[model samples]
Target: MFMRKSKFRHVFGQGLKRDQCYDNIRITKSSWDSRYCDVNPKYVAVITEAAGGGSFLVLPLSKVGRVERDCPLVAGHKAAVLDIAWCPHNDDVIASASEDCTIKIWQIPEGGLTKPLTEPVVDLVAHQRRVSCVKWHPTAHNVLLSAGSDNKIYIWNVGTGEVFTEIDLPDLPLSASFNFNGSKFACTCKDKKLRVYNSRSGECLQEGPGHAGAKPAQVAYLKDGLIFSTGFSRMSERQYALWDEKDLSKAKEMNELDNSNGVIFPLYDADVNMVYLCGKGDSQIRYFEVTDEEPYVHYLNTYQSKESGRGVGFMPKRGLNVNNCEIARIYKLHNSGLCEVIPFTVPRKSELFQDDLYPDTPSDTPALSAEEWFGGKDADPIMVSLKGGFVPTRKDALKVVRRSNVLDKMPTRTSQAQSTNSEAAAAPSLPPKPSTTSTPPDEHVGFDPQGILDDMRKLKLIVKAHERRIKTLEEKLSQYEVNTSEEDEGKA
Candidate 1:
């Protein structure tokens, strides 16, 4: 039997033992369409159901065992968290969108959560309705994109807490993905249309019909200007399609898989050009090799399991075990409150580094800044070699400088007085100049008394503003105290 001579043909999935898996977790039961989980080399975050608010649990990758019943949670959102994404440049930074109609960015400590994390570093409040999705830019630092049920898409500069760009869609976007360079993105919407748009300008360059079925669909932008999507057919059968960026009016290749009701998620690895299709509530993961050849998409293999998965998260390439010939790792969330670790490895007899299977992959360093990406500048992702294994660089703290009103920037009266005193003291005593030739008003050498008066007026206004702000804060504090007392009384 002559098989397709490919490096990934012998790839097999190996599941870790029960002791190595994370157990006793309370995964969310929200009907929202999301992975509900995100994994990095350092930690794994899973959304859990909370009583009065939404929360997620962050666990260290090394702490693989039964989770404690009273584990600390990242509970900042007043409503259920719909989606979450980890920043590519910083492992400790994450963004979460919630049904509270807001998106919050959180920073975890190096050792994971020691107590309940109730505060977020940045809170973005622009969506008029519940936010459904959040995605970090692939190659830019401090850049994030979010979609809301209000039919609006916002690109944010997380560092400065300002919207870099905005895109209005005809309908709610079901799924969205950024291209290699962060220059463009493709989206699948509830209107059953696939559209590609400019990331900065928000111009729709291409639009076409998507899957005919009414269920949710997912889209992923590939390396060589290709798009992969998965959705249900008109007959309710699950199907996947490949499309050329130049033409979306028709799929380059479309194939039907099964009649499962769960939505299929297509995860693409640009290094190997392989796409893994994992469906919610399905026990198997089907992967395919995408090429520019006749068939375009080739079926590689499937990894089967007995327990069904509620959600799944794929780890980055740099986290794989190169010595064990591991190419990819997936963290599968089971309905039984267990997170299983599955590693996909290519069988090989060579004891040396296999160059064929491992190429230069995307490094953690970002190639562009949010300002550059929003200013019409584009660059591909920075790549690094994995021959000697991966070592992460030290990341600085994520500082969020929010936008403020003009009054907030005004100098205080005490500082202004200090500046005036300093200026007067630094003046060289000229022994009273003898009131020399009558100096023209335009060429006056002395400080303007009128200007001092203006400064005094401005300082008074600043003082009034500060007093108003203090009074407001005092009122809020009193109200909060009253509410707390009432709540205590009710509990008693």
Candidate 2:
């Protein structure tokens, strides 16, 4: 017998709000770095330059949409802003990397910026070439890092403007991410190699061959100290490889996927140990779960759409729904607009609490000084609590996924059809009893190809008719409900 499935099942939910996609938000098409905030999910920052040099515009997100009237615009970078990273420790502060070869830190007031924030809190001017990516320290607060074309990565204190470590390399770095404990970082370089460096000592911990193509690669750390990288092969096929961060002697698993024209960017969810692979020109985000076993990468499902994305942004775990077991939320950027994709757990309605949804998510804690981080101690990230949580539920929180669609839920239709065909073809010779009772005309008893098609078409038409009637009734009911609610309010 098949083993029982887990109580919590993860799947995509309806996009939260209407009028979701925002158009003409200034975003750099070339840079792969995230231009939105992951720490504070309430606001999102983007580079918007309709008339001239791009300025940083912060939009306060509401359940309905972004509040455009009170949006704040910070103008400081002389050139187009390539990347923006919000400080995980402080929600009011953010940093921007620009093509001016300088990184600027801007502070957003609590009530939202009334006027343009033309001045920056601090500026670090050291990179020789254009800056590409800026990432805040995961565990250590106030510490930020920036990589530029000057073939150097600089880690500095965002508040003091002090350089803690400058990693000089021979090649330009593409992407960089701190490990789980912030002891080390794995970065991708222009030479098609992944190099993991010690955070405090700036020593190379490991190096190995990645996707082996000319295009830039992206890397991220996994739950079991394994690091995964995505890049293209010599044949121009997109692929990803997983390796142990400590031992780069061999890759744990290397898998090639559908050959596409865009580079695959991996978005990891530490809460669920699932990695979502999204490509530049693709309309679907493919995800897989990594386990501690052979064939570690288990194929999940794909979320598809009609339009493709120029860029995608992932929200932090703390912002996700702890009650519903939300794995991740992706913001897909199209040429005209932006769309949010949310993945939620499909738990049984009878379940009391989903234990899997609430992992120790990467969260912010008290800021640590530079001395504390360099002291060679493990710093743990704060996690959102699961047991005795804030959100209250009345037994059944989320709706149940009912298997009401007969055709959609049926799994043995094909096998049954094949068996019927085989039996009809290889049947024993019929006895003379078939001639009894005036020998009724031999009707076509086997599966008729046209008959099945006709039946399916009829069923589809009937479903559509029923759907139309239901929609009409729902609209009328909604109108009546609104009227009744207004009357009740008046009575009250």
Candidate 3:
């Protein structure tokens, strides 16, 4: 009764009640699997792998602080379902990979799966080891990638159930992710190498010594052909690094952090140019701002909690409430219930902030089928209305952090990141900067059309030069084969 509520002025720090959690729910493991989804926006998916691995539960949050659990259990994997992803092109359809060494794609018939959906529409089996992870291509339809402990990454076309290609890695892959355009991807491997792949040709675009230590690392792509990774140092301390995709030998920035045994999972927000690093078994999330300049990983604040998080889920960009100036929302899985954590950025409670930040987000209905996605087309997400279109105003929306002990569970904000010069800041990692910056205004604002066109031309030339190099290498290898054949005949 002594703690005052006025201090928590902006952050929405509410915890899910007992009923909000899926009854008798538990997660599989948090080592490399982040098993939570808001792909449907209206409904979120969480793996019930703790039930010994056959199914998952989809909970719809159409109503505030309430979850719909009547949805059917998606079952088919003979073994524990390790990972599942909602197709970006088709909201209802989902893809899952299992320890059974197979991948299955299921469609969420309207009103959710009513029966014990026994079979998936498409089943793919090729991985020799347990498929640990699966990721859908950001801009491509029906294109999916799977990573296995067998040290292989497979790209597949779910529609045809055919393997598009496979990339063999030097070590076992811990995780994999695609860039914004789906033309490239980055994966963190157990051997401590971060490998970037060309999605179009399945070529190893770049491989570099990633994290400084022997443990597994996490990698995420940033804007403008840059990548950032989180891992441990040689001395078993937590450290993260940023690198230019073009040059693997030199790093743009690398910093050692307080050593924690838990592995840090890197999640990137492309719209805001920020990356949130969540550690395994840790309650709070450490986020950083990624700019095109130096010291790219500028530490933001941490959303601390009393309960150590077991697993976490990130809501898709389009599913968020822009009217609240919401940047990103995270659902953390705890032993008892799921907590919805939303980190926002609003400058003062005024109509000006609303008009400036609350622009219409992409909500057009997506292609209904994988066939439509294969057409190489893009569509907006149909704008979803929450609470029957009654938008919550700024003060009305800021939720109070609810815990058994509200005062103790309140998040402690700090700044411990470095400045833009690659030097750690005097004290806090990241402090609040101006809401507006020197960033260029877009055409939606004041973009330079000529400058953009010039940049495209330069990129086109680079692609052509790369093609020429590949052709020359192929020709040289062919000639070498001819010479070796003649030498063998002479010897005979």
Top candidate by TM-score: 1
What root-mean-square deviation over C-alphas does model 3 reach? 18.6
Query: How far off is residue 131 in model 3, in Å?
Result: 0.6
| Residue 72 Cα positional deviation in candidate 3, in Å, after optimal superposition | 3.4
Candidate 3 TM-score over all chains jointly? 0.69
Predictions: Cα RMSD each: 15.9, 29.6, 18.6
What are the Cα lDDT values of the candidates? 0.82, 0.66, 0.62
What digit string (tens of lDDT, one per residue) describes model 3 on residues 37-57?
334555567776445456776
Model 3 spans with C-alpha error above 4 angstroms: 1-24, 29-39, 50-53, 63-71, 337-347, 351-492
User: In model 2, where do residues sit more than 4 Å from their true spots?
Assistant: 1-10, 20-26, 29-39, 63-71, 341-343, 350-352, 386-492
Across residues 5-96, which tens digit of lDDT does each residue of candidate 1 receive?
67888788988998999999999999888999999889999999899899999999999999998999999899999998988888888899
For residue 55, give model 2's deviation from the true position in Å: 2.1
Clashing pairs in 2: 9-346
Q: List ranges where model 1 is wrong by over 4 Å.
A: 396-492
- TM-score-based ranking: 1, 2, 3
